[model samples]
Target chain A: MNHSVVSMDATMIQTKGLTRHFTVKKETVEAVRGIDLHVRRGELVALLGPNGAGKSTTLRMLTTLLPPTSGTAEVAGHDVVREQAAVRHRIGYIGQGNGAGHTQRGRDELVIQGRCYGMGRKAARARADELISALGLETVADRTVSTLSGGQRRRLDIAMGLIHAPDLLFLDEPSTGLDPQNRANLQEQILNLHTEYGTTVVLTTHYLDEADSMAERVIVVDHGRVIADDSPTQLKRDHAGDRITLTAGHTDDARRVADRARRSAGAEVTQSGTSVEIRVLGAPQLLPGLLVDLANDGVTVTGAEVARPTMDDVFLNLTGRSLREGGAEPADAGADGGADGGARAAADADGRTTQNQEIAA
Target chain B: MSTTVAARETNTALTGTAGPNRRRPSLLHDTGTVFVRELLPVLRNPFSVVFTMVQPLVFLGLFGPLLSDFPGTGEGSALQWFVPGIVVMSCLFSGAFTGSNLLFELQTGSHERMLVTPLRRSALLIGRALKEIVPMVMQTVIIVAVCMPFGFELHLAGAALAVLILAVMAVGIGALSYSLALASKDQDWLFWTIQQTLLFPFLLLAGILLPLDNGPGWLRTLGDINPLTYVVDACRLLFNGEIAAAGVLQGAGAAAFLAALGLLVGIRSMRHST
Candidate 1:
């Protein structure tokens, strides 16, 4: 039904004020307060947020896994609630939990998923074979999913989602539990798949590099609302900007350079000891002029380095909290609390948070 | 790592549109697939099958001999009279408790995975319920064959009807059990507390340990309202060669009612469940 709509580069996902709130033990935790997001066809968008950011809740509502408390989402040109089957048929979702049966062999699980999507057995088998080889899952395809390592199983979960070759693929933190090497490998495979199939791929992750490297457009969600949405480069340029660092012979020279840099370039400049850090919007071309002006101003520049801002810098510029801190939580902090509770209940329901954090900012 | 190779293959082989199963959605096919997946694990673990059978067999071995000397066991032996109750009890335990596996499924994320699929929620419940039927039938048949040496004379057609009754009972119980499991998704204690509380009362009221007909008036009246009492009665009538009797029909009717009710509850719960 979606394919019948003849427009090229059609809008793949459209949500308007989609919100969900849960009453966990008499406390109403607003997981996703309200979020409006749009993704055109063939775009790889990453929902970048921390643990309680409500990125997972957005994906869940978009994928038709959970109903939004208010507002609406149209995924793959079908209303997530009214035409759920249509949406479900057109999209492949691989949730954060990997969404796989433990005892089933990875290949068989893939085949069943293919069948669920309405693929003929022969076609399902062929696609399963191709995906197994392409994803480097040939080694683990025949093994029981429970026996496979987490990385291997996650890859298999990817293969399962890819079985039907859906128009849109939703991955909720695909690389969360993966090691660095495997994360990179999976990222490569995902990018390759998107490029090959031209599927609208939306993933959520708190991993700075994964989002920075994998997604072309990063939709930064916090506390159930979109904080910033743009290409990684553009977001960096708009929010954090490029930083030019100049090391002077003395702290007096550093301060003089910082003052001149601030006045002449109209940039945000700060000096620490003998180093002056200037955050300027168009750093590359502005640097040469600023250096020449600094020389003209009689400030000796000992060393200079231009560092492009990272996603974390962009996040810091947007929200005060750090993403790395969410990852470095104590091992037992969320161990037994996996069952439904305040923050986690919303987490499980595809919820969001940090709206107050955003509002306060 | 080889992006070019994958991209080249994708250009040549992959299509622009995805949305399989869009043309035809068959309930039987979907249910069949789930049934196979559900049963395969049980088949692999022989220990589970043996463990389930132990309870019913224990009822037959320990209770059957004790009742032989006691009065009120009509024409045939006490083992023959007691076998149907044991069969239904076994079916009740094995079938109604299939939800325990669902607890594991939910924990493992498999249940959530299934829900995201295009498979109908009703089909999901039915498929899981169907998994209990074949095993319950097989277990009941084995119990009947075991009772043959203890003066148990089973009418061929009646024996077949007894299997049907057990299967129907299992479907009803299995569907209801799954509903409860889905409602109490991750809360093992909530499900178990309700399950244990309801189960023994049904067993005791159905008079699985003794015939309630000879019991006090109040107990017999309580047994009359319990659906399992009718099922056990139907199985008894079937075992004693009353396949066409009104009591047999009533028993089957009670089971059918439970099955239909369980299915309704199961489907409704599944629609709202995780």
Candidate 2:
């Protein structure tokens, strides 16, 4: 076990061309494409993708909930396929669905969860008390979980995952429906877990802000493949170019401003509202000339602002599609489809459109 | 290509080093975790406690008195015969209700959370089934207490032994029912309705209220073949101590077989659905 632990520290998680596919009604959908990954000890890694980007599938495969179609995923130095029990013991997972029994009090659930992990009743109870107090669940500790607010319940779910003090924790969209405050609280809890306990965390999220703030490293998955992997700042620096927005006088003048801006900046421009936004690698050098060029050509600019790009921009650069546009047409195309399927498709489309629109923009 | 590299880098940065090689959990541990999580809701909810107690009481009271005036009211008082049957019925009814919790958990995302845990596969079934057993046993006790004055005598000294046997049967059946609920996650109403409809038919057909000899030939044969009939008969014989050693053994065997079958189906169904 110590030897395994040494190797585990060397590579807490390692995957080679890991892939997962599903056949739904005879249509084979590749949810996780071939990819290689190596996770190190005590890191908080965020799996970021749009709805169908396969973030959950990746988590599922790594967690042993779903087997990989090809390649291999090893967790804590054990193969997810063959040594699933080993993998399972070392990791704690809090999936998108919350997975709580509402009728139970928050603290009681944690105690039982600990006991299930082989802790004695006394030990489990002590741990439960510690977590409930640590997570600020004291007020709701004895309340039936069903009576808890959404955010409180999610917090309890996190507490439950940590009851066994697993070395690796998997959180799938942990803050999906949480309020801003709850989301912040959860982010703090995650950071605390990593810092204080040296627990490794692998989480998936659609919230770019959450990903940027919470995750030390971000993995942007698109169409079942790794689209971008880097520190948030590095990713923004690499793919999220400088953004220049020119608010036009009117909608009628939007396209003309966009075309001129596009040519002058040697970048792509898109019209949103009365603004023609241009994204270029070097916005400062290009901006002055573009402003002058527009002024000389009698194009009136109401305002201009240059800002650093975001994860959404990084996504656009990688997949050529904008995340926001995926649902511009239908709000519920994926509703009633299982949670995984809907999420997978959304993430995939986010990746594809980010690339396509990166070129078009 | 650059995008993929960046994404790969990000993936590694976040999840790479934190998973699999660590100390994983065991089956016994995981099952216990799941069971404790499930038990809370059943124990705390007012409705659950009421339903568990009231349903059995209702069956014992309504059926016992109605049959008392009937021409064929046999040896003991109607309440005496009906009490044990309802006690068995409580276990069966509550066992089937286990599915509701699974269905709700799936809908609310709790099921998915549990799936990701290293908790043992058997834990889910065991935890849920056990959670249900306490209430079921309580319901049986209440029914027995209520029927004491009505001429139904349940040997209290032997209550623990009887409850233990009944509990094993209940847990097995509960697991089967829970698995069925998971398989039909979104179609709970349909599944539950089907379960309810199947209940009385199986109950009546199994000879719960009357002896197998009293029913029509086809009915008697159906009772002989019905699993419910076996369970009721087994519980009755054990409670009445009418069966000699062979009869007790046969009843125990039948209960065990059905319980095993139920557990197998339930676990298998859960694995497939999850």
Candidate 3:
């Protein structure tokens, strides 16, 4: 009811060369190298990275939790450095861990959060009641925070942040420790929050599918800088294409099928025995044609399945390394690199894929 | 804690509507809210309430009476002189230990959560400082009340001054302790080391246990330097309603100065903290 509509393209966050360096053990660790990023109003952006990536650091800087060692970032239309109070007023932040007092009841915590944002007693009470019901926390609202389960505690944390009804919310690894069922439940709740309030959400997650499913735009961060930023579909399309596999009744038939698929523009086909693997951009549309030609050529197409790429594939294709390995493989080259010139060449290929995505956008 | 996602159907009114300007929570209100939150644990937990009150009570019951007959205790009488010291001791101990709550908050990530809010940084520290004051006053009252049953004479204005001095001492020490916690959020050992070590010097030099009248020259010199000495001296005189006494006035001045110092350190540490 108190919503104030903002322009569609108005910037919600803008950063120029935002960087942070940490001195650990008397040695400099460039946690966040230079990374320039922008997010428009109402966009749900995910900062996806492996464990050591600076995604959390970037979120901390934007939320006014940590000061950027260098560069500038303006969040929610307020400069993070000089105008933290102003930025804090318009946004809610839920960190990776629980943020409420241990023994306090969930309702009391929410009410206190509301009061901290300057709400009057009756109004804060009403708001706490509204939040308890909105987040489906009525069951746990009366329980002490220490007694609630992880998922319930996470929801209560979100309730605390939302008590003031911020326009923009920052969540750091929101679903990291939850079971699959609880993780899915929390995602649904977050989505509901975004849809109902029209809030601009910025969350960080390492899970491939979580980012792909929840974020409208995913910012792939590695080594403290933004390596790629685009929609999940666009990222997969440009970095890794669809995989189409076809099997025939005979090795000769498979060879024939591969020969024909190879003739199609940009179709990379490999033949072995009775099976043929085809990598192409538009697999669904070409699948029918490929099957027909093979049938007309006396090759019985016994099996066919097309698979799509995931965020992991995008990471592998971009860094020539796997995020599952903690992104520790040097970008330039290794066993995981290029798919050939080692790791370094593979890393370059990943960089090119990111450039292509930027160009396409 | 069991993982209980209640079967209550998924639609309700928990979604909030308060906006940035829907209400500007006043600074005073925010501080009060945080203060109340800090006070709840103390009241709810029997162990905490008992522990906070027991030490001073023991000192007053066992230590004060034992020292009432010690030699060279001066003309003020042992109980008369010792009560003021105990009062100051209560403030220092309660206020300083109150910071352990801050240390707990830091460990639990609640401190960081509070930082991200619109609540003022100063308010967070001030709220906790204010919470410490309540117990400090309560314990001081109990200490004073116990001394009354011991034939200890009372000066109405002096007793009031003593209570006020206790609060000032608490605020100052609590602020300093909180600052130390903020500086190193997780190194609780460091806080304990300082708490266990630095406090004895202040307590002993302030002459809480016995009169320092005939102590070595160095001990008396240190007492003169410690703010507690003036406070203890003033509290002793004020309890007799010696309002015009210079020592009473000096103790008030010292208490005010220490409160200001503690607050300065507290606010500076908090403002500059992450």
Candidate 4:
């Protein structure tokens, strides 16, 4: 057996041109298209994408749950395909659905998960107990998993994934079905664990706020390819600009403001009736100056507000479609339709949109 | 939130391996772990154990008296010939349907959780199949005990050998069921269709409920090709205290072949399940 040493700052995940295709009905559907990723240890990254954008497929490949149709991936310093057992030992995975048997108790599931990782019986018991308390599952730990509420079950799932204290962890849509309160609670628990253990976490989520609030880095995916990768702050600044909307007393004034706003460098100006909206990189600083310029031009500004850019705005700027729409590009949708007679692609997009609405609600 | 305490404890528990030298348990250890997990649900609900025996008991009670006076049942008592056949029948019904639990696991993603662990791939199938032995033994004991009052004598040594043969057959059937479940994926209809479709043919051809000698030549020929027929014949011979019968060796050979083929296909499917 060959043993490869891993340094503290070593890359936890590395993939080059990683791709996967699925044959839905004799016609191939390219789920992931040539994804290249490099994640260092201790980095909390979120793969931000709508449903069917292949985020889960990518996570599956990284966790060795699904073999990539083509390309290479090394997770935890072992090839995902060639050294699956080695990769499995070094990482933990919490898939999209509940991972515990319905009839088993949460505590028993945790212990069994530990035992699967080769822990001794005594050690497994001790670890299960510790996780039961740490994840606030002490009360529900003895009950059958099916009896637990969604929040409790999701927490138990997290505890199961962390039983062996893996150096790297993968979560697929961790908060998709969760209500706002439970989603916030789960996010806090995940963040706390990541911060305390310095465990590298790569979670996939279509919840824009989740990726913006919890992850240090967000990788935006669209049409099975990465469109942008940066911190939430940087992505907002680069892809989307803050908006400054001003309403004048008359249409002539709004038109004059739009004309002047266009003269400013890199500011996009649009006018509708008596309102002029200006999109600029720095709306806060530019708002005050623009107000003074309008005052000097003898144009009375009745209303003025600066709105900060959101993750949705960033996605819209990059893809020309709202993330909430479950944007499967028209061209890609047509291609999928042409290949499989349109029903599958249409239903898939509709299903994703419904799920996105649930998360949004 | 106790996060710090949990984190510190986890570090100690995992034993910071600086390299790929993490300690993995042997195959036997992993199989034992999986076996315990699979058995816990059955142990918790003891009623299920008896519930599964209801059908076999029904067959024995309603059908055994009718076979008592039938001609050409060989030299042994009809109960002796019928009891072993019921035991084999119980193994068939229970073992062949064990895959339903696996299918449920696949749908719930519990099996996927096990897959991501360091447990050997073969251990997953082996441990699950091994769990079938416990209930199988219990049912066999109950059937024999129920018939003892009806003048069915117990040959302890021969019955033990008969149980060993049934256990082997059970493992093979369980593995094959699990493989079918995997092949069917999450399609509940496909799993049931295949299991139900093949089960009746196997049962009828094996002639567990009747002797094949009185049947048409084509039926007898079909029974000759049925592996379960040999297994049932072996069980009857063993239960009759004929430990050295030629049928005993042939039944064991058929059982060994089934076990080997089942494991080969099962492990292949498990490895390629992703």
Candidate 2, A250-299: lDDT as tens digits = 87666668878767635878898788888787888888988888788778
Which candidate leads the pack in lDDT?
4
TM of chain B, each = 0.89, 0.83, 0.89, 0.91
> B97 in model 4: Cα distance from truth in Å?
0.9
| Candidate 4 residue lDDT tens string, B1-274 | 3445544444443323222227778999889988999888888776687877777888898987788768757655789778888999899899888999898888777998898998898999999988999889988898898899988888889899989988888889999999998877757788899999999899878988888889999999999999999999999889888898999999998888788888888888787665
What's the distance in Å from true for residue B249, model 2?
A: 3.5
Predictions ranked by lDDT, top down? 4, 1, 3, 2
- TM-score, cand. 3: 0.86
Question: For residues A3-92, what per-residue lDDT tens digits would candidate 1 score against the true structure?
Answer: 664145479988999997765545566778789888998999999987767788788788887788899998888899998878888788
User: Of the pair 2 and 3, which is ahead by lDDT?
Assistant: 3
Q: Candidate 2, which segments miss by more than 4 Å at Cα?
A: A1-9, A195-198, A246-278, A282-302, A327-361, B1-37, B40-47, B69-73, B130-132, B156-164, B210-212, B241-247, B270-273
List model 3 lDDT by residue over B150-248, tens digit each.
787777776876787777777788888898777656567878888878888998888887778889999999989999889888887787677788897
Candidate closer to the true structure by DockQ (higher is better), 1 or 3: 3
Estimate every model's Cα lDDT from 0 to 1. Answer: 0.78, 0.71, 0.77, 0.83
For A1-361, candidate 3 gives per-residue lDDT tens digits of 4434334447889999998765433434566778899888788999988766778778888988778889999887789999888888888899877888887788888878887887777888898887776667778888778899887888888878887778788998899888998887778777776776578899999899999999999999876778899999999988888889998888988888899999888888998888899988889998998888877887888999998888988998887778876654456654543232222222222322222222223
Clashes of each: 8, 60, 18, 0
State the displacement of the C-alpha of residue A287, model 3, in Å, after optimal TM-score superposition.
Answer: 5.8
Cα deviation of A212 in candidate 4 (Å)? Answer: 1.0
Docking class of 1: acceptable
Model 4 CA deviation exceeding 4 Å by range: A1-4, A263-265, A288-302, A331-361, B1-21, B74-77
- The sequence of per-residue lDDT tens digits that candidate 1 reaches over residues B45-92 is 645665778878987888778887566665557766788888889899
